[model samples]
Target: MRDLPDPGPWDEPEQAPPWRPEHGEKPRYRYWPQGHRPALQALVDGRWRTLQVHSRIDYPDGRVAYQGEIELPVEGRPAEHHHRAYWWPQPGRLRVAYGTDIAPT
Candidate 1:
């Protein structure tokens, strides 16, 4: 019978094999929530301004949440300022109010 091919270095028992064990693990954050609506209102010197408000929300762990930049215009300034805030559903309602100003920027 024909001689079979040698197993080579891989067949050596003294050498350790290059293999990694599998460990199925889950991620730390969960899926984001739905039906999240955010509204913004601007004011200057205790008076409400005409500028509109914009916001975004991200839920990481179901209970814990994160929010992004909120942009709004001041009374006199031509540019918009961006602010960030976070909220907890279990706690009471949180509102951010501002006063009016005469100067812009």
Candidate 2:
């Protein structure tokens, strides 16, 4: 198991305002609709590879982010690569704890 490191500072504010969450669990902003699978590019094994979006989380303050895991090659074998995935549709960039910024393909 390859555990990726924790993500760094988010490009946008991660926390929703106190009054926001009280309204409901639904995100105020909808960049990518729920159940939509978006493909993004990330740096894996020193090369850019396409990764599929597994799930998404929306903040009450209208912020949305995507996350998922990808299989990576390690020592000539495929290994589960877990990364702290955070997708910001506004910037059209995906940031992972693996030390690179992923972008929409």
Candidate 3:
């Protein structure tokens, strides 16, 4: 019988979302789970804006959260906005749609 070698940091994801200078160390990159392509939206400037999900987090409190970027028309060269949202059933300033349950803009 052969002994298996220890896997260092095997829990880490193979790929991670791009790191932005604005994003501090605490909110590290997390992998978005497969087959869980839920469109996320956040209330921005009094309107719901769709987010380009970069990372997904499953909190210890049984709440799922998403962090991503959104492009909005701002008076600047870069109009990309960063935001986070929790999955539906968790009261938040965001909305989530799964499968064919998409909502109109």
Candidate 4:
């Protein structure tokens, strides 16, 4: 069969840069409900093509930041948590690693 001449809506969008895991783990921020939380950052989002992997974000100081944080307040408490997650892109899907000795929930 011959290849199609002009592609239509099938055109793909700009792909996101691949994430580099630090010591075999990506640096991401996670959150918890508190009281029973992880030692480090809590879980938010770590899948491929996710908004959490934004390239550049505008900072309050008129500076572009490559990273940002997401958090939520705990119920009936005046505390909250932020977390970072690690991810790996695979064929047609993505892989996530919480951290050393830590598994994805």
lDDT of each: 0.30, 0.45, 0.47, 0.30
Model 4: residue 55 alpha-carbon error in angstroms: 6.8
Tens digit of per-residue lDDT, candidate 4, span 39-80: 322222332232232223332333322322324444577634
Worst 10 residues of 4 by lDDT: 7-16
Model 1 lDDT, full chain set: 0.30
TM-score of each candidate structure, all chains considered together? 0.24, 0.40, 0.44, 0.19
Weakest 10 consecutive residues of candidate 3 by summed lDDT: 7-16
Estimate, for each residue in 27-77, the C-alpha lDDT of model 2 and write its tens digit.
433233334556565554345555555555566565666555555455656
Question: What ranking emerges by lDDT with the best candidate at the front?
Answer: 3, 2, 1, 4
For 38-99, candidate 1 gives per-residue lDDT tens digits of 33333333333232223232233343332333334445767464433333331223233432
Give the TM-score (vs. native) of candidate 1: 0.24
Pairs that collide, model 4: 28-84, 28-85, 29-83, 29-84, 30-42, 30-43, 30-83, 30-84, 31-42, 31-43
Please give, for residues 31-92, the per-residue lDDT of candidate 3 as tens digits. 54544445666555566667766566654444455655555545546665544333434335
Tell how far residue 21 is off in model 1, in angstroms.
Answer: 34
Name every residue pair that clashes in candidate 1: 43-99, 44-99, 44-100, 45-99, 45-100, 46-99, 46-100, 76-104, 77-104, 77-105
lDDT of 3 at 77: 63
Runs in model 4 deviating more than 4 A are 1-67, 78-81, 88-105
Model 2 stretches astray by more than 4 angstroms: 1-36, 79-84, 89-105
